[model samples]
Structures are given as C-alpha cells and as structure tokens.
Target: MTNERSLSQKWADFRATKAQLFWTGIGCAVATMVVGFTWGGWTTGGSAQLAAAQAGTTARQELAAAICVDRFNAGGDATAQLATLREMSTWERGKFIAGGGWVAMPEMMGKTDVAATSCAAQLVATPAPQAASTAAP
Candidate 1:
C-alpha cells in the first residue's frame, strides 16, 4: 500500500514536467513549419497546383498570341489592318482582334481574351514592313 502511494505521488509530481515537454514539442513543430514555409521555399500542395495552372494558362495564351500574329501578318491587307488596329484605343484593340477572328485557333477556342490583348499589343508594337521601291536607286 505504501509503495502504491509513493508511485502515485511520483506521477503527480512529474505531471507538470510532462505537460511542459508536450507543449514545447508543439511549439517547436509550429515554429519549424513557419520558418520552412516563409524562408525555405516550401509550398503546400494547393499552392503548387495553383502555380502550375497559372503557368499553363500563360503558356497557352502566349502560343495563341504568336499564332494570331502570324495569321495577321499573313493576310493580304496586313498593312491596312495594322493601320486600323493602331487607330483604335488601347482598350478597344483586344476586342478588335477578337472580332477579326485572329485568335480562333482550335485549341484556343474559348480562351481568346488574353490572347487577343497580347496579340494586339504585339501587332501595334511591330512596325509594318516597307514596300520595295520599283525604281532602282
């Protein structure tokens, strides 16, 4: 009976130390996570997935814009179209390109908005090719 009582007393005395150790472990785990995520470049699964999706969207838009530029330049009246495109306001250029069906690639069917805007910017920035003079200098 006495031994049992002593064992119980020892357990009671050690309870505070046990609780402190548990809390310390929890705090260490939280701190490690914070440091890892903030400075160690650790990303959660959802964040990685979101980043991948954004990258794919950006790549698709870029490809569509490139194809749109090629199609625009291949047209018979590219100079005239470029003149008209330049005359429009910046905000209207995207809609103009979309309406012209420059971004109608099969893979880019429903995703023309970003591609149109990018194509318009590229077209406006690029200078039209000069026509060769027939008269020899």
Candidate 2:
C-alpha cells in the first residue's frame, strides 16, 4: 500500500542519480587528460622555466666564489676565509664582495672552486713577531 508506493518512488530517484553520476565520472576523466597534457606534457612551458631557474642559480654561485676570492686577497688565512665565505648567506656574501673585493667573476662556473683554491694556495704561513730578540748579549 503506501509502503510499497514509497519504495517505488525512492527507486526512481536513484535511477536519475545513477545517470548523473556516470556523466560526472566521464567529465572528470576528460578533465584529467586535459590537465595531464597541459602542464605535465613534455612540450609544456614548465621545462623551459626550470632550465632558466637552474642557470640563474649557477650564475649566482659563481659570483659568490669570485667574491670569496676578492675577500680572500684582502687578507686572512685562506682556509679560514673559505670557511667563513661558505657560512655566509647569499645576501651577506654579496654584501661582503660589494664591501671590498674587486676580483672579476670567471667565465665558467667551475672556475669558482679553483679560484678559491688558488687564493688559499697563495697564503704563506708565517710565524708571529717575537716580542723579545733571541740574540745573546
């Protein structure tokens, strides 16, 4: 009677919902493909942007090494200078170079390591000045 009628009405509502669900699932699949090919695709602009960012990072590191070299020549134990430079923030390193060193950045990025090593190589270990002369009276 009324119970049977309500059960039929509920089944009808479920039927309409099933059709809507099928269409929604298809739409979601199509959208997934579109996005996969848009940004994740090989031909997309993302790779070029990544390469540009990497190149910029490399340039900055080389500049930092050159500045480290300049600061090195200004004076200090080479080993100590290199350690100090590496510890500095990128902004602080830039300030350090701008504050004093005039050495030029090398054309190639790999040259920075060598420049730091060379600066350290030139350091001559000398003994401190003795306050008293060691000559016999």
Compared with the true structure, the alpha-carbon lDDT of candidate 1 equals 0.92
Clashing pairs in 1: none
Stretches of candidate 1 exceeding 4 Å from the true structure: 1-21
- Per-candidate RMSD vs. true structure? 7.8, 10.1
* lDDT by residue (tens digit), candidate 2, 31-106: 9878887876644488878988888867665566556555565665645655565666544554444344433355
Local distance difference test scores for all models: 0.92, 0.55
Tens-place lDDT per residue, model 1, 7-113, is: 77887776467889999999999999999999999999999999999999899999999999999999998899999999999999999999999888787667889
| Deviation (Å) of 30 in candidate 1 | 1.2
Best by TM-score: 1
Clashes of each: 0, 0
